[model samples]
Target: MPWFQLVANGDATDPNDYNAVGGPSCSGPNHICAIQASPNTNNKPIITTPLRNEMITALNTNSSSTNVQLRTNP
Candidate 1:
């Protein structure tokens, strides 16, 4: 197992120095797995208005209007 040594910023080379570190802190449910609904806040104004989908594709990934499929075939 690997050991972690927490030393002061300026006293990193000092062998006699020891620093306290923080542990994991959580105040919610111990373990919970659920689908998270994330919203897309970044989108082009012109492409977002016409599309009915809430989560729009990112505009900075060299993507164009033709890259998106607006409909599904029956």
Candidate 2:
């Protein structure tokens, strides 16, 4: 799944400040899930508008002092 990792100064090798965002699964269709919502119907996960907004807020808040990196894999 795609994920976002927050690291200190955008340095992933630091191993000090690391926060991951993305890991939620739903069994049914059209179900609203949090963050990385994985549904059973398709490979592409549906990201609700509210969830997307929240993520953007979080990224903006943390990005001021740290670096947010969007990673495609675990």
Candidate 3:
């Protein structure tokens, strides 16, 4: 998720009225509120290398085994 705040020249009615790509824009009669974003929750993994083929094979296998398996790089 993210967080935002209303800035000067920003209208409280329409927050998305102004384009907020290259920072805040407060140069009009219709006050534009500045929008800011907060850091996102870190759950995604940063993989620099390709995943092992064996792991992919096991995951693709449809077996009746009850034991769960975990794969990790050594």
CA lDDT, every model vs. true structure: 0.23, 0.36, 0.29
Question: Could you give candidate 2's per-residue lDDT for residues 50-72 as a string of tens digits?
Answer: 64565566445532111222332
**Model 1: what TM-score?**
0.16
Residue range 1-74, candidate 1, lDDT tens digits: 11112232323222233222222121222111111121223211222333313214422232323322222122
| Candidate 2 off by > 4 Å | 1-34, 38-40, 63-74
**Candidate order, lDDT descending:** 2, 3, 1
Clashes of each: 0, 0, 6
**TM per prediction:** 0.16, 0.33, 0.21
- The residue ranges of model 3 lying beyond 4 angstroms of the native Cα positions read 1-20, 39-74
Question: What is the lDDT, from 0 to 100, of the residue 41 in candidate 1?
Answer: 39
What's model 3's lDDT at 1? Answer: 20
Q: Find the candidate with the highest TM-score and give its number.
A: 2
Candidate 1 achieves a global lDDT of: 0.23
